[model samples]
Structures are given as structure tokens and as C-alpha cells.
Target: MFISISIPLADETRVRPYTIASSPEDGDLFEIVFNRVPGGAGVAWLFERKAGDEINFTGPFGAFTLERAPERELVFIAEGTAIAPIRPMLRRVFEQKPGHPVRLLYAADRVEHLLFRGEIEGHAIAHPQFQFETIIADGGQEALYARIMAEVERRWVVTDNDRMRHFYVCGIGAGVLRIRDLLRGAGYERRAVRYEQW
Candidate 1:
């Protein structure tokens, strides 16, 4: 869903849209992740925030809620910074479906490009039901495809081919769609894969 964050200026306020990264289970506060752009006004404005600073942001609006795929395995694919929205969704899976198998394939150009790397890796370490893989896409398209394909095949070994499955892809622009396509081409139903949208 979309969240409106406002930067208060002397005579006016500027607003930007960011995805909500917290689930209702996370309590009253909603978390959002953003990076500083090279020459971005909003980035500059947001960076000036202090720990106790107050910023104007509104709503956790969206229909991209998590579902209980009890009859199927749940797979999440995230690219670069898309982990922001997927974080709480993944958390919900852990909360609502205790023993279910959940797999996450997150890709970035480099280790430094990954967000919440430690957090996600730590979660996977603590939870045996969840499997995680990181793909460094700097190795070219063919290499990236091979890595993801291997991970998918590995998951298939444990996952029932006859059982239904749901795939969630979250990332910037075409990246998410490309992942969706990969999953679809791998024999998953078109309707089973969901991607983040504008």
C-alpha cells in the first residue's frame, strides 16, 4: 500500500509516496524504508530528521495484504530494495502460519545493495521452516538466471508439484515482473504469481 510522507518546509510542505513496511502485528508504528538519492530533495529533507523528530506521514493504504496459503507453499521474491514491503508480509507468514514452508529469493547487484540483509538472514537462521537465498545479479543475466533457477529447483525438491502455490514478487519496475515471468515459465500458474504494482 501507499503511504504519504510530508517534508515540512518554511512556507510549504512536500509529500512523497512510500510503501508501508509494517504489519498490524508491529503495533502502532508503521515502518518505511528509503534511501538517499544523489540529488533528491526528499532524500535530503528526510535525512535531516533527528531521532525524536516528527514527520508527517499518512495511511497504510493498499490491498497487497498477505494471504494464508494453507493448501500451498508460499514463495516470496524480492529485488534490490523491495524488501521494505515484503518484510512485514514475511513476518505475518511467520506469525500466522507456524509450520508452513516459506521460501524467499532476494537479489541485488552487490552485497552492499541489499537492505535488511542481516535481519533476513538472521530470521532464516532462527526459523527452519523458512528458506532464504541471496543472488548477486552483477554476474550477468544468464548467471543470475542460473542462480535463481537452482534455488527454485532446490525448493521444488521439497515442495509438492501437485499442491497449489503462491508467489509474491516485490521490487522496482520491470525487475519484479521479470521474476514473475521466470516463475511462470517454470510451470507455476499465471494467477499464482503476484507482483508489486505502481
Candidate 2:
């Protein structure tokens, strides 16, 4: 879900949408992640703030959350900080359906840029039905898409229960659209895919 963060400035306030990164299981401690981009006022203000500093924000709005999709397999594709929403969703999935098969295809240009990689990999190790893979988008031309398609074929498309699957894609807008297009072009119904892009 998305939240509107309010930054109290000298003259006025600045508001920006942030997807809560912390799991609802994290309780009162909500976390939001961002890279401080140059000339980004909200990002700058957020980074400069210290603990206990007051800020205002509203809404857990977005239609990216889970839905009633029968007993479907779940696949999450995320890039960079787009992993924010996926974390909480994954946690919820594990909490609600530990034995359900879940796969994550995480893309980043560099290994260091992939957030919580080790932590999630650890989850994969512990959860028998959980699997995770990393894709470096810039490594080669169309390499990321190729890898994602390969994963879909190997993990989802080939499965006997392929029709009973839900795909969640989160990343930059273009990437999300491209993946959705690829999946649709490959014959997966549009309703089976859900996305949140920035």
C-alpha cells in the first residue's frame, strides 16, 4: 500500500507517497525506503530527519494488495526499492500460507543494490516452498527479460497448476509494463497479473 508523507517545511509542507517497507508484522515501526535523488525535496527532507523527529503522512492506499485468487501459486518480481511492497506482502503470505509455493525474481543492476537479499534467501532456505533468484538487468541486452521468461517457463508455465497462479510485478514503470506484456503475449490471462510501478 501507499502512504502520503507530510514534511513540515519553513513556509509550507511537502507530501509524497511512500510504500510502507516494514511488514505489518513489524508492528508500530513502519519503514519507508528511498534513494535521495538530486533536487528531490521530499527525499532530502526525509533523509535529513533524525529519530523522534515529527512528520505527517496519510493513507495506506493502493490496489496492489492480495486478492481472492483461489488457491494460487504466487510469483513476485521486484527491482531496487520496488521491493518495499513485496516484503510485507511476502510476510503476509508466509503467515497466512506457509506451505504455498512462492517465488521471487528480483532484478537489480548490481548485487549490492538488491535489498535484503541475504535475509530473503534465508527465508527461502527455511521455507520449503519458497524460492528466490536475482536478475541483473543491465548485464546484457534483454537479458533480464529473458531470465524472467526462463523462470516463468521453468517454475510457473510448466507447472500443471499454471492456470492457478498469480503474478505480482513491481519495479520501474517500463519494466513492469514490459513484463506484463510479455506474460500476456505468452497467453497468461491479464487478470492473473497485478503490478505497482513507479
Give the alpha-carbon lDDT of every model: 0.73, 0.77
Q: List clash counts for every candidate, in order.
A: 0, 0
- Collision count of model 2: 0
Off by over 4 Å in 2: 7-14, 67-70, 98-100, 138-163
* TM-scores, each model vs. reference: 0.75, 0.81
Could you tell me which residue pairs clash in candidate 2?
Answer: none
Best by lDDT: 2
| Model 2, position 41: C-alpha lDDT score | 76
Tens-digit per-residue lDDT, 1-198, candidate 1: 768888876667888778877677668776777867568777688888889988778775776667564556788877666777788877777767565678888887788978888888887987898888888878754565556656665665336564267888776555456566766777778878878843
Which portions of model 1 show Cα errors greater than 4 Å? 7-14, 138-163, 185-187
